[model samples]
Target: MMYKADHKDSFPEKPGLAGLKVLADQNYLSDPAVFRNPADAKTTLAGELKALAPNNVSYVYFGALPDVPVAPAKMPLAFERPDLRLNGNLCVLFGDGHVESLTVPVEVDDCEELVSYLHTQKKYSEKELKALSERAHLLDGELGL
Candidate 1:
C-alpha cells in the first residue's frame, strides 16, 4: 500500500521482525491467503527475526492492508473500488539488542537486499553473514524468492 503519515506528531517506533514468533499466531501466519498476493509477499516475520538473532537488525511495519494485489494480474478489472485496509508493525532484534521499525514498503526490500548483499561485504562478520543467509532462506520459504 502507498505510505501515508497518519500521526505525524509521533515518530513511529521502529521494531525488528526478529523474535516476533507471535506473528505466527496472528491471523497473518494462519491465513494462507494473506501470502497469496505478490504485492502481499514477504519473508515470514518470524523467519526474518530468526535470521537476525546474531546481529543488530530491527524492523517494524505500520499501516493499513496493502491495496496492491500480490500480482498485478490478480487485480480486478474494476478501477474505482475502495482500497483495502491493513494496519500493523514489525520489530527486529539484533545481536546488539538494538531494535528498528520498517516503516516503508521499499524499506523492507532494501533490508532484504542488504542482508543478501552482506554475503559479499568484505570482512563482514561471519555471524551476520550466516544470519543473512538464513533470512534469505526464510524469504524463499515465504515469498518463493
Candidate 2:
C-alpha cells in the first residue's frame, strides 16, 4: 500500500494496488535506487530522486531479536499499553525511513518453530532471494556500476 503525507488525513479509498497498473508500470518495484544507502551518497541526488518519484521508493528496516534462539518468558510490550497483543517476529519497514521496530511473539520453546515458519515464508525463499539478487545485478548493469 502506498502512503503519502498529503493523504495521511484520509484512509485510502482502495486497499492495495488494484486499479493503479499504469502508475505501477511507470514506477519500478525493487529498484536499486530505493536501496542505495542514503548515508554513503556525498550529494543530495538520492533525496532529489526520492522527491521526484516518492511512490517508487521503499526503505526496509529489519529489526533483530536480541537473543534469537531464546524467546523471553514474557514478550516485551510494544508500548506502555498492557492490553495490546503483540505478534511474532516481523521484518517490517515503512515507505519512509522514519520508524523501525521488532515485535516477536512466541515462547522460548517455540523459537525453533517460529524460525522454521519464517524460513518457509516466500520472502525468504531461495527463488525470491535469487530474483532480488538478479534484479540488483541488473540495476548495477544499467548504472554501469
Candidate 3:
C-alpha cells in the first residue's frame, strides 16, 4: 500500500518474482526471509537470499494489476502453489491485503506428483517453464522424487 501511495497508485511494471524484488529494494518489504513462505521449506531465493536452500521464493505472483478500479476480491496479487509446499490449500494474497486459503486438487505432500504437475502445464510462459524446470530438477536430485 505504501508503494502504491508513492507510485501514483500503481504497481511495479515487472510481474511475478521480479516485481517482488522492487518492493524489497525499496524497503517496502525489507526482510528477505519473509519471502520464503513457512510451508515451502524446500525452496529458497538464490544469491543474496540464500538460506540453507536453493532457488527463489514460492508463489505465483500476478503483478500486472488492472488500471481500472475493481472489487478487491477480483484482484489476486499472489497465490501459493501448494503442490510442493506440502499444503492442501492455496494461500492467496488479494489486492485488498487479505489472504485466503483456497482448497486445491493437487497431491500436496508427494514431491513426485508435484514434479509431474509442473511438467504437464498446458501453456506456461518461459519464466514459468524455467521455474517449473528448476523445481522439478531440484526435487529429482534432492528429494529423489
Error of 1 at 36 (Å): 17
lDDT of 1 by residue, 11-67 (tens): 112222321233423323443223222233232222332243211112222111132
Model 1 error, position 123 (Å): 5.5
Consecutive 10-residue window with the lowest summed lDDT within model 1: 76-85
- Top candidate (lDDT): 3
lDDT at position 121, candidate 3 = 33
The estimated TM-scores of all candidates read: 0.26, 0.25, 0.60
In model 2, the runs with Cα more than 4 Å from the true position are 3-41, 45-123
Model 1 residue 20 distance off true place after TM-score fit, in angstroms: 4.1
lDDT of 2 by residue, 1-145 (tens): 2433344522222211221222233453334354333432322223433242213222211211232211221111111111111343233322232233445444411222223333343234455334333433432332232
Every candidate's lDDT: 0.29, 0.28, 0.55
Error of 1 at 110 (Å): 7.2
Off by over 4 Å in 1: 1-92, 101-112, 117-123, 126-128
